[model samples]
Target: MNQRNSTQLHPPTRHFSVLLSPTPRGARLARLLATEWLRTWELPHHATEAAEHLVAELAANAATHGRLPGRDFRLALLAGSETLRVEVTDTRGDDLPHRRPATPDGESGRGLLLVEALSDRWGVELGPVPRKTVWAELDLSPEFGNVCSGGSGALLQETREGKKPHQAPPLPPTEPAHSRE
Candidate 1:
């Protein structure tokens, strides 16, 4: 069972949340969905890509380390004028994520290190009961303020009304068009 919701805290803040099964597929889906949403919001290319990676690592950790039978993990994205935050919550409060030195020959145990490197700041938060949310934040560049031409309120309204929010302008064709002879 998957659930999704969107919220507008204020004129400059936007939020999106979804609940997904705690599985490898779910973690992959979280990354894909987050990438699409970030692009829809017209965030800068670098920031969007960075956030995508952050979501992937955090969601993977939740699915792998925080798994509980019949429990779903939650992925939440908060976009503000100056920052973008990615969070993944699971039903394992006692199992908190920590950074450790990864062995050179080990294939695993490097997700948190990647998270720390890619995010401006990252941490874990314990919830009401039997839940924990791991979050990472990226500081947006000044030009990010100019990406949303329609304004955050308008975008939120479109989302609430079930209309597709404005998308970034399409990229130019790689080759120039030829003139008719």
Candidate 2:
């Protein structure tokens, strides 16, 4: 069979999100979970690495500056046609983040710096219950080609013809008990 004529298939990478608690351990888990999830989506090595770094920084910020007693933070990853949006929300509405001068000798204040360098766009959102969400968006179109391990033209054609690609099923809730039940 001619190499050009041989058929190839790759499952679609879909959008998904998750919510985790606001703690140092939670921040670490966020990075690990994001790396695994992105791999399932076929994200390339570079994109996966970038996602891990961004998640770690944002989650750390949430655990440090945005934490409220007994309230947890949330980490969400949303894949789009051309971008991936990473959101980290915490309960401290009063502690809005802003760009400030980092001390030359200080070993702090670099998380936001890293976030700005890695993301295409980022911003903050106010929530319903004195909460705040900080999000960073990363472009995924380029990585998808490498990640899919195939040309995008064919995938586009398939999508144009109204075909749905296979993807991992939604994750079941991690909460152990259902008190209402």
Tell me the whole-model lDDT of each prediction, alpha carbons only. 0.73, 0.67
Cα error, candidate 1, residue 144 (Å): 14
Count of steric clashes across candidates, in order = 0, 0
Tens digit of per-residue lDDT, candidate 2, span 1-181 = 6566666765444766677778889899889998888888776565566778889999999998998778888888877555667889998877777555689998678777777566545667777668988887655654322332112212221222343333312223431211100
- Candidate 1 C-alpha lDDT tens digits along 90-180: 9999886765567899878888767755665566678869998887776565232233211221112213235342332222343221111
Give the number of colliding residue pairs in candidate 1.
Answer: 0
Off by over 4 Å in 1: 1-10, 142-181
lDDT of 2 at 78: 77
Error of 1 at 45 (Å): 1.3
Worst 10 residues of 2 by lDDT: 149-158
Candidate 1 lDDT score relative to the true structure = 0.73
